[model samples]
Target: MALDGTGDERFYPGYDYTAPSGRSGGTLEVTETAACSASAPTDLAANATSPTQVDLTWTYDGTNNDYYTIYRGGTQIATNVTTGSYTDSTVAAGTAYSYTVRGHNNTGACDSADSNVANVTTPACTELTPSSISFNGVNTAAGDFSGASMVTPVDLMNLEFRVTEGTGGGAPFSQTDNFDANNFGNWIPSDTNTSNNWLLDANTTPSSNVGPSGDHTGGGYYAYTESSSGSYPETYWLTSNVLDGSTYALNLDFWWNMNTDTDLSCELHVDVSTDGGTNWTNSVWSRTNNPNSGDVWVNQNVDLSAYTSNNLEVRFRTISSSWRCDTALDDIVISGPARATEVERLAWNPDPQEASAILTNGNSYNLYARGTDPECGTVYYVGGTTTPGNSQAFTWSSCTETATLNAPTFSPTTTPITGPVTVTATGTATGIQVSWSEDGGATWSAWFANGATYTPTSCITGNVIFRAQGTGTCGTLTAQSAAAAFDTTDKDVATLTTTNPSPATGVVTIQTAVGVETAPATLTGVSVTIGGSSACNVTGAAMTWNGTTSRWEYSWDTSACGTSAAETTVTIDVTGTDPDCGTVVNAVQLTGVTIDNTCVDGTPSTITIAPGQTVGGTAVDLTTLFSTTGNVGSFTYKINGTTVTSPWDSSAYGTTGPQAVTFEVTGTDPDCGDIVGPVSNSITVNNALGTDAGVAGVASKNKQLDVTAP
Candidate 1:
């Protein structure tokens, strides 16, 4: 209600509107601004302890940082570092490895480049096992080296690994015979006689006179010989890893036929030679009724207790035989105070049991090692426990003994993890999803996609593998994560992209938008994060409202990316958000207020002409009947349009009478267009003059279209 006193005088709406008094809006200024202290670390490190193990650890500046991410090579290994350290001990030995670390706040994360690498190689080992030893009339084959390639590496002067992978004895590259051949009498000389040795066919010719020395059949072959002097009958004699004070039993097996046996009876004798084979002592098994039949295979055992030193040898001879005691021995095996290398400890995953205890003194067990190895050891048990086999520990007075332990089985939820998988998720962009499997692809599953990070519930035990898969024409393309392993009771998180950012650039404020349960959600400490990290700018709200739209502006200059302001940004949909949104939030990248001129340029540009107005020579107005209209970039452009000009030009526009001159702001500033559209409206001066001459009273504001009236 206007004041009654104003009735006596002229009253204006704003006549009493002195200076706008009552305050409507004002900013609360704070001189001293408090900020969360620095919390996240810039670097992380992982160390290698064993051949196939890596221990990763990082630093946390306190509640200021959310979580951490670890990477191996270019691939991320784990996110959400609840504890300070992590151990990966399941990968195969002899592989190369590297790692990196990144920290996380609630909103997003800050990542670091990869760390130095940790290289490891498996240890050298020896464990020989041959299921069967066969030697007959024509050809003979011993050990698994039968079908092996003829050519060998130069370093392998004595041997090559029989097999890799399996517990027949042990490791994939386990050594069989110590081809490093250091044992005193390890290398036994063979007979040089190729023919007439009876062990050779009658058609075969002898290469040289029979003697004990160095000789061999190339191209994977075997030959035989006889002792003419009846000295050390065969080439190799038991070398002592023992002492001279020890007594022992000698065992031997030979192949011969009574028909081939010389008319002279070949006698079996036990010879003892100590002090380097110079002096000799011999014993005889002269019984005529002996298992003498050559056709049938016979095993002979003799006691050498009467020998003085452990350096004793055995021999066979027919002194006065006409056929020179023709003897043919295929294989001669000796078992005495011998130490066997076998499975010391066995188990896939032993429960709280000491590994040392599992490998006891001397208890042999059959080993059924499948999947390519030398030969299965004595059968212990097949297809049973993860760690099978009996305690076959080596009791060397010196060297270490170990039993084979089968690797624990893995149960992953995913297989060959794919990338860019289109999954129907709650809030995520269309991209690829990665998955993985452990234990020989036993189980397969996906990681929980949390913004820029993913975490698997349980840990991985043995083989851990991940694949990046994506949608393609054929199906899905999955790229494998670097091959690595772990042991039982191991847990892992995928840190494909995990890290925390702190001390933002523009009005920097780190915060968590979602639930802050995991200390290590994807990116952390961002103003508004899709995923939540433990550390946030949490003053009972999302970080800072830092955007070009807000009055309190922030600077996010893209001049210096990467190291300057690069952070993990996980994009998400916002049904409950504002339409004037910008790019996905970067952790705490923005620093101070940078020039962000988002203040809409609402300068009036829509100058208009009223109806029954004329400009130039064109008639344009409502009374003139101009029905058709068109849009143009700028009214000036429309007015000045010439050859090859749009139909909106004044020359082609207005349909009749007085043409009006005007401008519009259809595509101009949004706010200004709504208010000042068709501005500067006016009628033609000639038409106005004509109407004035015919009028009686002063022209009103509407009639005097060119006049500005209150």
Candidate 2:
């Protein structure tokens, strides 16, 4: 179709070829639709403030008129909110929750796409006051508050904590100004209002300026209350007395209550002074607003350990921003660690510090100390054991020093002590000293170094018990030894006497009697010696109990001295002992113990025969040889240097000339086996009638004839 003309602006359909002038015209039309939609919200975030609540927020390009729809786990939980923030309170604790938000128009038809998913999990409940806790003091991870992952690691080391709780011992000074006493004057006021910090009136209604009806100091009559009339800053200073902070870990506790008619500013400031209140520094408990939750009184802990000085003071101040009920304070307590008292025990040995006290068995020991703190007063201690010989150091947890003492042991505990007994004390250590007590430990002897021997006065009479005491090296601590007993009254002292034989010429017999002064006792043994010679044979039996008459006899032959007549002194010595008594020795002497010679001779007379008389006269006799008093026996004779028979023949002396002849005698005795006498005789014979007689020869015939003639 076509057509176009100058003014007509018409077109004709069949004018293809130029059949032109004819044209057709009608109406022409065009149409389109409007687009209205929204984009997705961006940057979704979530926060779980508590176990059961999750707060969500998001960013979006939507207009102010658009609202929001929050979905949890792909399900809508809240809708049509004007703000981008939402709180879901229906969530469970320790559970993960997925959330998303979409911006939408008020018609709910035009809506943006869902925002990014926000995953959040509530944290588990943690206890504020745990039995123990370990904090590394480092935060090592980045995570949201609601994440379930651990943000840091914790380790526990061996640590000791001393939490002292008390009022007096820890602190050198404290004050509780309830106004009952004039102690309120302690709080010197340089400020304007003095009555603002006084005790609360009894039975008064609670106001901003006063305590509640039941509010009072702990276990006291009234509470210290602060009330102001106008907007004037009120300050009260309470400076503690001088305290030695260097020796203590100081702490304070107080009960406080805050109430305000209007929410006006109230404050409590704590400061420490090292120069006795001349200077001040803020303490850990200083607070501008009342830290207490409500009008009820609460306790708070404050530490002042940082100010460790010998001279220290603590100050408390109360100030207010306007005239309102400020704060109520009650029961202020101050404390610190107590100082340990110094003490020590002395060593058991005196000279060496490493020695132990020796104690006796079955005796109680009294432990004494010399060096101790007088502040703690006199310390009395006693310790004992049945077993002795111990280097024992006595220690007390409250004391600062330790010491030990040595014990002593007594010997000769045998019963019925007949003889003098000696007791000795010994110490386990070198320097330990000892003392003794005999009167049942009633009185003690002076201290003896090392050991000592003692014989008590009661040794012979009554039952006696001995005890020993040991002193330590420091001379402070002492230990007592166990008691030893010696008992019995039976004692014996022996005396000896000797008697010589009656006849001293024969065997000498000696007898000794050992007499006991005390009865009911026996002699152990006895020995005897005679004439300074131990060759004597002695025989005796030990005496029995109560048998004091015992004889010790000895027999010795006097002839054993020599086989000759001699005079000698005989002496006897005896020694004896008893179980209960000591040794007894005695000696006896005999002046004339004559050992007579067994052989003696009488004077011999000369014998003469007129002449041989044919050499046949009666035999001449010579038999006056020996004289013996004791131990005499057979005799022997010798003549002319030759042995002769009894009834001797003088013919052998001959009728010839003169013959020489000698005679001797010897005697034998049992005591003196053989003895020779000093008697000897010489004889000469004249042969007058014999051949030589008258002249030579002769023919004269007179001798031969006369030899037979007489």
Candidate 3:
């Protein structure tokens, strides 16, 4: 009210119109929250297929950051379901419920706005055919069969059954109350260790135990008897699909409290069908876990590996027990593609310098030579399943002037073995082809090859010689690498190549081969020495290769040999050594040395019959030749000219012959060094007197064990 430059604290009623300017201010009130929405379907699912359950898919997203505040008409149903769909499987059939969704983020405070209401009704079990199926023990007097015929699955697809037993007048199998739960079918058949033991009883109608259809149906009903006096079979099976190379389990309810069968092993077998319903095979490998209570629902799983396979029909061989038991079956599931290891790229070129790949894992695998190896084009050779998982990698070795995947070959040194033995062949190469025969290539094998990893599938085991061939059409078809023996008892022999200038810590390369012998010929006394002393360290060193002499010597004790072979029988001990390797002052940095023999002197025990010897042949008297009178331990011998490791304890030592005899002790001892002369000796022997005439004629032609390369 006041006005004009008059500074006063008093309120002038008359000068109120002369007010001054002021700043902006307003009310920021929070608005009232929206009401919670109604509930929606919580668990939504879709089973529009044969399953009799309701597949309900509902949503409750009326509001965000909230639960699916669901309601079933009169009452609140599901709450706090954040997913987009909900399946109400427990709904009643033919009856629909109006559903509305409201968001409630666990706050218990649902939205007030209800979702657009929709009604849904549950579906009824469509295939309502009540089924009854069971056994009618065997009949002896009729010499045939009697009792209720089997219930064949005319409706195999979309089929379900409930056991209804009685004096035969039956209703819908499931509705028959006298047959459920506590009760079971009568005259059950038990599987014996038999071919045909469980059959129908003698006194019933449907005299032919099988169904009118005339197929083999196990134990009929009502008129069957129990007989455990003979060795027979009773294991029954109802055809079903469980084999597809898929992981699956047999879900059944079994009750076998009174089991008396000893040769019984209850199993769920799945005979597989791979070819679109043409041929069928068994797919059951190892038996799964045992069946639960023989009468109660028990779930069992079995690896479907050992079963034969076909296209569609997979017979489920249920109980393997000979004792009368009961098992109810349900929901069998098949799942899993779990890959432990898979070779996605298996490409290789004959030329190591070119693009190539090798397998290092020592497991089994089949190398498929693809004409189009993504990068290598269609290769000619492919490998088969490799085993042991450790041979996953291979080397592109060099032979002569060309690169190869082969090991060093050798003629039997020290004691000469049979002639024309294969020393080495390509280890890992493209299109590896190999075959062997003692008949001078008169005939060859189902020769095979690997893609790139030149690991052999079939090994030359016996006296038969082997020759490997690798073809690289892009390059050329290389001749057989080396002739090796197969089906032999010879110890495998091989050489180890090291890194050129090694890691200064000694060289490292996989020892791919061992000399051919029946027993594994271990590389004993193998030591890596520097400066001409036994050492384990060779970390850093330099050496010069004399073009002519090809010899190397270390100047000083570069590094201590940390790597040593003193640990195992197979592993080679490499000394770790490091020092200024052959500098201007020291000269040579690294050198190669041959290890001394560490084979424990074999023992010569009492003479037993030898494998090959005639009654009149020179019996190389074991007592005279191998008597522990000298150096002897537990000894192992070799078949004349094979690399098969024969068991040490022979029931009989054959008569002496132009044959080799070598042996070794069980354990090593400092007191006992490598066996002297293998306690080994050789003598020629003739055939035994009382031999099979056919064997006498074709004894030399006895087939040898086939070699399978890995």
lDDT of 2 at 292: 21
TM-score of each: 0.24, 0.25, 0.15
Can you rank all candidates by TM-score, best first? Answer: 2, 1, 3
Error of 2 at 527 (Å): 76
User: Model 1, 1-710: lDDT tens per residue?
Assistant: 33333223333433442223443343323243334332444345545565446677665554655666665432356877756677775443343344445555554344333333232233322325322211111111111112112111111122211211223422211112221222213224323233223233221123232211121211221223333443432332222232332433333322222212323344434354665466756543321212223222222434443445666554443222322333333233443332233333333321222323343333323222211222211221222212222221122111121211111122342533221222212212224454445443335565433222323323234444443433333232223333344442212221211122232333332222322212223323233222221122222123333334321122323223223223333221111111112113322323322222223343433233334434322232222212112221232222322222222223333344444444322223333232333333333323323222211122234532221111
lDDT of 3 at 151: 15
lDDT, candidate 3, 1-710, per-residue tens: 43343343344333444434552344323334544343434443333322223343554354544555555432355765667666554343333344545555445354544444444443443334322211111111011111111111111222221111112211111111112222223212334344433343312222222111111122322211132333333455444432333221212221112111221344444455556436656644223222221111122344443333423344444443433322223333333222223343333322122211232222223221111111111111212111111111212222222334442233442122333333445544466554544443345455544321222223233323344545332232233322343332223332323333332333332121212222222233223333333554343344332334323223332134433332121222232211112111122223443323233345432222222221222222333222333333444444343332322223234323232343321211223443322322333233344332111111232222221111
Question: Which stretches of model 1 miss by more than 4 angstroms?
Answer: 1-185, 190-271, 278-509, 513-612, 615-638, 642-710
TM-score (C-alpha, index-matched) for candidate 3: 0.15
Judging by lDDT against the true structure, name the best candidate: 2
Q: Tens digit of lDDT per residue, candidate 2, span 529-573?
A: 445322333344332222334455555666555345454454545
Give the range where candidate 2 is weakest over 10 consecutive residues by summed lDDT: 144-153
Q: Deviation in angstroms for 598 in model 2?
A: 99
1 or 3, greater by TM-score:
1
lDDT of each: 0.32, 0.47, 0.31
Model 3 CA deviation exceeding 4 Å by range: 1-338, 347-391, 395-461, 464-710
